[model samples]
Target: MSTGLAELHEKARAALDPVHYDYYAGGVGDEVVLAENEAAFRRLALLPRVLRGTPTRDLAVDLPGGRLDLPVLIAPTAFHRLAHPEGEVATARAAAAARTVLVSGMASTVAIADVVTAARSVDRDASVWFQLYLQPDEDVTACLVERAERAGCTALVVTADSPVFGRHRRDAEHGFHDLPSGLAAENMRDLPGGPPGGVRDIVMSPSVSWEHLDRLREATALPLWLKGVLHPRDAELAVGHGVAGIVVSNHGG
Candidate 1:
């Protein structure tokens, strides 16, 4: 039986450690965005339709390259190992079972290849996508994208909003941002750290400009979809750049 999202969330909260639960549920500082998220939903009214008896309910979505079993697709969330032992590998398997898309985050605990392999093992035709956090150096970003292509990622979902990490007070109270020892973002294993003994930053490029997407296009053949776009003007700019698609998001609201 399928549990409601709210129920699942409460169960997860009850199961995890306090610090980890904060990491899972907390958003950026003050959480005004977080509180208002559900508030926006409460204002919406859905009218019930009269019974036009039909058992078949199609939820598929057609796109440029292929079709999704459902319009829903998983977003790129980092560090799945903190919740499950299989990490993104388990997520890929679940996506395969549901015949949909799983956009594995660049900062996932498991290697990108392992996640892809796990999905294909579960279902040979699973469509696995990869998420990218653009690096400071263009060459580095190129290498990462190429590696993802080689790993059999069907598409690339590039994160656009998180040039810098958000400050979450709930996690901060738990010392989640203190830069503890041995806490590495797995995909960033060999990449440059800010300083030898200093805090290990996310290594994303804050100065990544509009033209960078064109350069990214020139780097790989995989379809690119930019995520975390909220502004209308930026959406128009993304269309100009010839993106495959745009995912409207507020990062974590």
Candidate 2:
């Protein structure tokens, strides 16, 4: 019998085309960092102690704004359509059923509003976080934050690991520059004027800075979080910026 995660992985592998699978699954250069990420988790040994009249296990965790029934949260990843036809909607439903959190990525094919609807369908009070790509324009970033707020997102996750796109040999080999025609980056589409180039070009917002954090705070009342922070100093800086939380990640390096 296969486990739920195993079944999900197999289904995703089968549903997505080979090139798309590699693009979503592959990493930069030699992929040593990717290997290390999984290896590091496996190296840690879980030390479970004998129960001392503990009736049940409690997985709940209290976050800055609310309580999470399960400490586990779905990390943001681009282009959920590659995983299943329902895209982020399906993932959000599953997360809600598990009584966990879902962090929707900026590159998600499903609109933020749709994801929010799905989450609400499962649990009216479900926790959903929106992850931003920091579009090439400051105004675009601001608009995304506002839209997420309208969608009832509880947190804002700014992914700052990618200053410039990394060299992904798999994507380069397959010429995978943009999301497939039917799919789109909804956050980018919500901006006032269209991005500098047509949708295919990866827009890099050169304006990302500490000052941008202030702009983000001004944009919405939702708690802010900075993902992709690996350094202790950067984590400190995020706190100084009045962010509520920090995710210690390197973006699979």
Give me the candidate number with maximum lDDT.
Answer: 2
Whole-model lDDT per candidate: 0.79, 0.82
Clashes by residue pair, model 1: none
lDDT tens digits, residues 1-253, model 1?
A: 5478678878888887778888878878889998887688678776767786988878788765346899877888888877777779899999988888889888787778888899899888778888887777766577568778888888888889987777889887887764234544656555443444332345666898778888897778888899989999999999899889999888776
Cα lDDT tens digits, model 2, 153-229, are 98888888888888998888999887777777655663557655334333656567878777787777888888889
Error of model 1, residue 19, in angstroms: 0.7
For each candidate, give its TM-score against the true structure: 0.88, 0.90
Report lDDT (Cα) of residue 249, candidate 2. 89
On TM-score, the leading prediction is: 2
Candidate 2: misplaced stretches above 4 Å? 4-11, 195-202
